[model samples]
Target: MESVSTSSVMDILNLLKACCSQSCNYIMTYGGTFSSLASEVGQLKDKSSDVKRDVEAATRDGQTPRSEVLGWLSSVQDMEGEAESIERKYNQKIKCLCSFPLNVCSAYRLRNRAEAALATIRELKQSAEFTKLADNLNLTRSIKMPTTKTIGMDKVFEELQRHAKDDSLSVIGIHGMGGVGKTALLRRFNNDFPSETEADVVIFLELSIDYKLEEVQKSLFDRLSLTWQDEVTHRDRATKLFRVLSTLKFILLLDNLWEPLNYQVVGIPLPAPPSKCKIIFTTRTEDTCSHMGTEKMIKMECLEEEAAWNLFRNSARMDVIDADKNVRIEARDLVKECGGLPAALIVLAQAMAPKKTWEEWMHALTIMKDTPHQLPGMTNNVFSILKLSYDRLSSDNMRVCASYGALFIKGSWIGKFNIRNSWIGEGIIDNVQNVMDADHKTQFLLGILHAASLTVRVHDDYFTMHPMTRAMILWVQRECGKKENKWLVWDRERVEEAPAAEKWRDAERIALVWNQISDLPEAPQCPNLIFLDLQVNKFLRKIPNGFFLHMPLLRILELQETSIEELPVSIGNLMQLHYLNLCKTRITSLPKEMTALVNLKYLSLAFMKYLRIIPDQLISSLRELQWLIMMDSYSGWKEGQSCEGGVSFEELESLKRLKVIGMTVSTLAALQNLCDSPRLAPLTH
Candidate 1:
């Protein structure tokens, strides 16, 4: 009897292996026909392996295998037999073509046989008993709630719940100032609605400043547990999403909307008559509510005086015994300075919780009083409160990262990878032997900023700071005795002329982006400058010769979306420069002197419509270049340009260390040559 059982197990194992291999190949050859059966075949393969292991253990222990194990083996064998029969039918149908005379009639006959085989396979797959197998695979799991307590928003939560219950309302809008507890109130509503209502599904998504419709669709697909192919087009994804959502009663909660979102673009069906879907979105502006066509608008207000004090005491862990009469007075005075904003109150209280003595409390108050408020349209007290929190950071590296957040446009989405690479170039992240270590340290610094509420995480590896937080960072930079470290004149500030020569001497980083400056001034005296960003200056014409004479430590230069006709030959003097961005310019050609930038690692020349060629000599000199972007240029020969002047594929052989290269369709012929070259094959791969 034992010998019979062992034979049965071995037969099952061999059948299962053949069944899995054939199913995988069939799916690969005929896409979409055998996809449904693939899952069942995989489960059978797993069950067969498990049963084999159990039987082996039983034999080793001198005991018989359990009856349930034998039953699983029998079921797997039966499934394998069905799979083999189907694969045999498919193979036989294909074999008809071998004896064909290669005529239309023979082709038609073979096609009919193939269709019959596919239909048979589909019917068998549908009739198979997969309930028991599915039961073992699917398991129940619970969703965890937020651990942080929601304070001082009881009335707001009640109002939001009321809005959610109205059957006529499709989109509900929540608008408030930044740090006014809008997100917290939304989370509370999301947690409570499923238990109190009859919605079939609940989804929460965070939209960043630069969010795309495809991203939102993918998020919905993930939340619904739906399977999607990676190669599916945007329209197909939208159609599938709409079909799935139209039949269910669902509620979508979107948080941190920087601008008005279009539901149609994101493939979300409107909550019209007969559709029970509802959407709730939060934004910082009332205009955004009007733009989104919210049926009901709710405005979030700050906490009252008593509630603010309660929140402050709770966050700071101050009890009655700890707060005497004088301490109560001082605490009340400090809370008043928070402007009834919950985030400010919590962050300030947490910063002050460590100071138990009266002198310490008084000293913090003195510092707040001494700091000057430079932000327009913001109250002085609120500014002081945020600045005090900035001062309380534990490390200088954290402070530097936080201050760097001020360099971006107030509502721009900052990519974490770009920020980390820039930090490495600027020498802010030290002791890093390689790029991987620098990335880890950058993430750590970003975490610190997020914990302190100095920045908001819009999505994975992307973040943006609140306008008030940005103001505080700028304030700290000006007052922290580092007056010459940075000069940021961004936000479309109209600049008819550049700063005086003396003003640029002490600055290390100078950004005059989004300005109205029409001319590039000569900066022959800037000895300490390392980074310069003059992007989106539409009227700037050209860089005069010898413009980069004095700056030897320069590492990053950005001239994207500018009208610069050419770069100065003097730019080659900065042998230490590593990153140069010249996208969306009108430069006709690159200067031969540019080949002198031996330390260059990243070069972007995308969207230069007038550029006709890249010289071969220029491409071979940058041995350290790792990333080269030359996409979307006008590759056709210019009016007077010769074919010999175009980029040569042979020049790429010397770039042995190249890691990434982006080019347009016109460069495919050249790319093919590079791929065929013996020395460049590895780099291309």
Candidate 2:
């Protein structure tokens, strides 16, 4: 039997190495091209194994035409040898030409050789035998698993493993205080479980406090690669999700549970009694785990003193071998102040990492000692540590932005765009000449907060403040004196009536949303107020006529989902108001006096089913109006009625700055006359 040529084997190996090196160099020099040629090369590389296997089988069988097979093999080897020679020559020419004048002859020769080599490769790929070998190969891509190493908590992990091994234990709970490393331990467990047990699937989800049912369903659908129809109702989605999950034997791991989650509501089916599937969850309170029906509870404790110091030293990059005795002593004391909490220790260490001197370390220690441990509204020490990080923010703008984020409900999600608008409305952003500038500044501030770990990203355009960070922000507000800043009362807070006049005297921004307030007390003394949110107060029946008289500086007023029947004639007094939200209200018509708000930029009257009219010149009079939301409203217009309550769309052409208009077909007819107007050409859907 004839053996394969040794030179051919060597040529093939060299060609493979050269191709890999060239591919890397091309990617680095030109980035990814994603062209068809590149894709074909990738497929050829994947088929190399099949090509070798087929050649081996042919040689062993010795049944086919040896001359034809050997001829094809020799051609491939010759092409690879020529390609390698061309690449080497080109690279050598490039190196020699880098420091001297270009050699035109050498450059032209190298380019010709490269083109000839490429042509040969194309010819080889087009061969019928090569194509058949490529078709016979089954290529698979492998993803590397993430590596996880927890610093402490071996005992807890052992207990968790024990519970997981027990076939009777379907649900296991891990609960601990904030910053105690509950998340880290859970992550370790997740990473190690697949190696220890056989499970069909493992799904990990971080359930923020404000996670909506739809959001959870969407996440599951995406992870499972299931198709969902557009505009499907929540119940339909839930049913579809249930049908999929009920058939799989899977392990579900949920983290950061703020409240007990109902599996059925979230479309997760209960595991059958004899199944090996398990469910695990982590939360701050054991009671929540109990409420979720966990069969076994694993409580996570803070690190020991020795382990705490070790972790802190590692994170801070502090070298004990070279440090002075005094610096070491102070560092140990600071670690103790962290209260054995891994998160606090790491953050504090990182914050102090750049300060190498003992004096800087002592100063940080003194500040921590002097700072109050107790926040007015919270009973946890987590805020004390979080405030330390907050105080270290780079600028006052960053601090203000972070503190302002806390004005939202404890677990509420805040949209980045909405918050930026609110900041502009309240005049918090300085030197912001236009909306674009304000948005840039807002994004910068949010980036700073995220880097400092003061806020957690919830989605692409939204974020949620950590509960401890929220508490610290409230403490900052109280420290600044709430009377001079923001005061928020929202979500489940029941207030029968608005604050007294004196209570609003020094307030700059007040939010009383999602409450049961029935009436607004006379607030004629709120001269410094800038933002007032009274949204979702269904029982709010009336506002005093004098309420707007003193708030001349007000910029944003939200009264959506209210029962108010009419606006006071004095509403025109808010000349500084830029945003007005009266959506879903029962108001029949806007007061003509509101036409005097020249600075109004955003006006929302959407879903006002009872709204029959908008005062004739009310919208056209606001020269700066940019966003006008009037969809699903004003459908009761009569041909014979007075035009006083009807808006003339032609008149809207005068408001040249309008950028967005949400209206129905009946209302869009108003823009017929303005269709040719260049000023209205930039309107967005």
Give the Å shift of residue 76 in candidate 2.
65
TM-score computed on alpha carbons, candidate 1? 0.44
lDDT of 1 by residue, 419-499 (tens): 875665455664453445657888887876765556777887899876557656766666543573455445566776666
The 0-to-1 C-alpha lDDT of every candidate, in the order given, reads: 0.68, 0.67
TM-score per candidate: 0.44, 0.44
Tell how far residue 606 is off in model 1, in angstroms. 0.7
Taking the tens digit of each residue's C-alpha lDDT, what string does model 2 give over 1-685?
1346877888899999998687545433321221333454444444444566666643332213245445555666676666557555544653332233145555545555555656666766666263222111111111123532356678888888788777788888887666777777777777777454656567777786567888788777766656656698888778777766665566788887766888888788877556678888987655577788888888776688898887777765766415778877888887776657687677776677777788977887775543423312222435654565577666776676787676677667899977875665555554444446657888777766764557766786899875546656665665533333345445547777776667787676788888889877664577777778898888887887877888988999988898998998879899999888889999997898988999988788889888876767677899987777777876533222245445555556687766666665353434443354455534523
Residue pair clashes in candidate 2:
none
- RMSD over all Cα atoms, model 2: 25.1
